[model samples]
Target chain A: MSLSPLGASRSLAAVFLPIKSGGLVDEVCRRIELAVETGLLTSGQRLPNEIELAGALGVSAVTTREALSQLRGQGLIRTVRGRSGGSFIADDALPSPERARARLLDLTRLQISDLGLHWRAIAATCAGVAARRSDAADIASLRGYIRPAAGDGQGATALAWRLSASEFMLEVAAVARSARLAREILRLQADMGTLTLLPFGDPAFCEHIAELSEAVTAAIESHDSGAAEARTRELIQTTTNWLLAEHAAGQAHTPGTTEEEAS
Target chain B: MNGNDAAPATAELRTLVEGIEGRIDDWAAATTRWLNDAGKLSGSAIDKFVRPTVSDMLLAPGSNVTGAGFIASAGLLGPDRSYIAWWQGEDLERVDALANFSPQSMSRYVGAEWFKVPVATRRPHVTGPYIDLLCTDEYVLTFTHPVFRGDAVAGIVGLDVTAQTLERRALPLLRRIGPRAALVSAGGRTIVCAAPDVDAGDVIGPAEGAAATPIGRSFTLLAAAAVA
Candidate 1:
């Protein structure tokens, strides 16, 4: 079960790559993503035997198999057993929104600013593609997501409404019809939502949502693809900055409270 | 009274015979042209003709025809009959018959074995004059020509000629020709037989003596000199 040269190269490239260590399973997921991105594997391309891949990666066959299974659960790969059968990449495989969200959450725990910068770049590109391809009906469907906040709303409901406002922007990404863009948007939104959920009591959050909704709608209605994309990126960055500032202020107050307790 | 009655009957029979004689002449002319034109075209040109004709015929009748391309490679020999590119029409169900008739298969029908014999072995071959098992009433005539691209014999192009419909339209003339005309492939496979009783599975071999005389010849005569 010696590994092929191609498999060995892929294995070396994916290991200890400065990403979070989720153990063997997470490492396999990273490798699969890298393989897809680099075009080493394409849709419908078959993977080597489990034993071969394990030997190449210098890991036990059982660990490699479990990693492959985890990748399958994420809709990244599929396995077929029997004669004339093996694991293959699904032609129409797209990461689920939940998986995207998990990845974003993992990134946010390390650095919010860096995540915001990446989100801006990705969303801008999506907006351009959506504007070029989307018809009037697609724009109308996006408008349906916007609704006024309910009176006397508290906690999750208010947060939910704010999140719903983000859909106008998300709809732009959807129209691009790029699976990669959609997955990345879902990841960014998930991370942003998680961070903002704690600070919803602040009035600035609601005001920021209102501004974002107006800017996105105006750009989209004008049929300006570039403007729409730029507006989306700007809004996301602004929101991220606001959340980071709030988190830092909270951290400062926590230290003061701790000193008082010690005294 | 008997003489007078016989005269009228005789007169009617004469007119019918004359009409049949005229149709036979027309069929002979048409068949000659069909054979000549089909033989002159290259394999690629024939395939081009088949694609459009088959597509129009199948789609016009509201049947979904899919997976069109030439059959090649060993992997195509699946249970689903993926070898033949074109799949629509009454011949769809005849996959089993075709499989059986294939020389590779043991259950080959009477004329089927002769048809499978390579064109090289049956020089100046003419097939058919036999009924298709699937379409029991309609006779299909195939004119097969050796396909060559460069120095190789790639395959053969078999053009389906519907003899039953042709006979109906030119029946009056065909009747005068003894209704025994056959359209055969180069491999000696009888593609269309006017006579209903002819078994397709029987070895047709080579035409002999006066029987070799084409009554209503339409196919283009292959230049015997050209086939090396």
Candidate 2:
């Protein structure tokens, strides 16, 4: 048996891929999930028949049927039975900032700080690696992602602006060449992206973020790992500091707290 | 350092360091099957057949497949070329935007390392420590493998894993090597540094007392026992 980390050897193919679990049904579910999560299968995009899908997967059609049922149960895919109908990615609702805010309010300042440290550690590592690993094409791509998104009075526009920064950061991770780092970044962004909004409608905050993006891109392009990592830390620290302050102030202003202030 | 003082810690380190390579190799091997699966379908079906598999694999409790999807060859999907299903998660929620349809031009992605490296190498390779837009909106290492149909290359398939997970899981193991021990990527990016003065993200160079050990094919964990 191959001395696989965390367990016994299972499959020849799994040796080259980091799989945390085993089974054909699990594999089928994994592939379908990869498609939807990657944006390959958009909301409402139809999937092929079970026989064809199973052929592509190199698994039996019965396995494909089971995977489809699992996906439907997870609400990731829905099947419509009729002419011109098949499995399609379920339409997910847009992320709610209120939900993000509530999540933030639930966390303590120390938890926020710990989370920030994790973010900085991941971002800094990526930036440092990216600075050394990137080539001309990499530099150009970084610059391309930095181009400013329009942010008028619209909420969607504001959200887009925030997502643009998040996307740029992920691009830096891609250049780092470590899949694990990229996944961590994904977790951080998913948890904090909505909460990291630029104090919506605050033009000054927007401008600062845009400038931060430019500075980061320039640092990565110059191959200055130190500067890239430092800048990334600055961004994370500033955001986390603001979040903690907001949480504290919100608590201080809670309804009954005014009575204590009067006393 | 006294012999008795250092012996047990050194032995414990050995046990923890033994099997990392096999694990990474295992994950990389599984992805080849995914690319092969994509090859069986038409280029248009790349997203439909090959993309969501990434999300499913990542669903495994400890699996680290971040963003998994296919990027079609330039001409296969026609002029406003199409590449879809690059699913990534920032937390538990799935966040992936279609490449060609976004308001901001993703035209640049075609030239990004994740796309260009696999196409150029025609072999399964790992590239990054760069931001991966399609997978995570943060630093990630993307393992990309080429998908072929017939004699020509059809597209590229990939998986992404973020650095934060590595640091969290691997740092403590390195710390056990010695009080000042640390783990760093092959590129010299510090994964975890035990010294109060040295921290993650610091681009550390060769050290006088450091002993470096390979942690899989991508990282090195260094331990330095300070002496008077």
Per-model DockQ? 0.01, 0.10
Model 2 Cα interface RMS deviation (Å): 8.8
Give candidate 2's error at residue B202 in angstroms: 16
Please provide, for model 2 over B1-228, each residue's C-alpha lDDT reduced to its tens digit, 9 standing for 90 to 100.
344644565554444433333433454454445455544444446545544465566676776555566666666556555454455553433333333343123455666666777678776555644545444555556666666655556666666666666556655655555667766655676656667666454566546856776654566666662311
lDDT of 1 by residue, B114-221 (tens): 234323542212334333332222244433333333343333333333444334433333233334434333434433343464422222433333234222222211
lDDT of 1 by residue, A65-157 (tens): 888888788777888878988988877652333433343334432487877788888888877766655555456756665543354233435
Off by over 4 Å in 1: A1-10, A13-110, A148-156, A256-263, B1-228
Which stretches of model 2 miss by more than 4 angstroms?
Answer: A1-81, A87-92, A128-136, A148-159, A174-184, A190-194, A197-203, A221-226, A245-263, B1-228
Locate the minimum summed-lDDT window of 10 residues in model 2 chain A: A147-156
| DockQ of model 2 vs. true complex | 0.10
TM-score of chain B of each: 0.37, 0.69
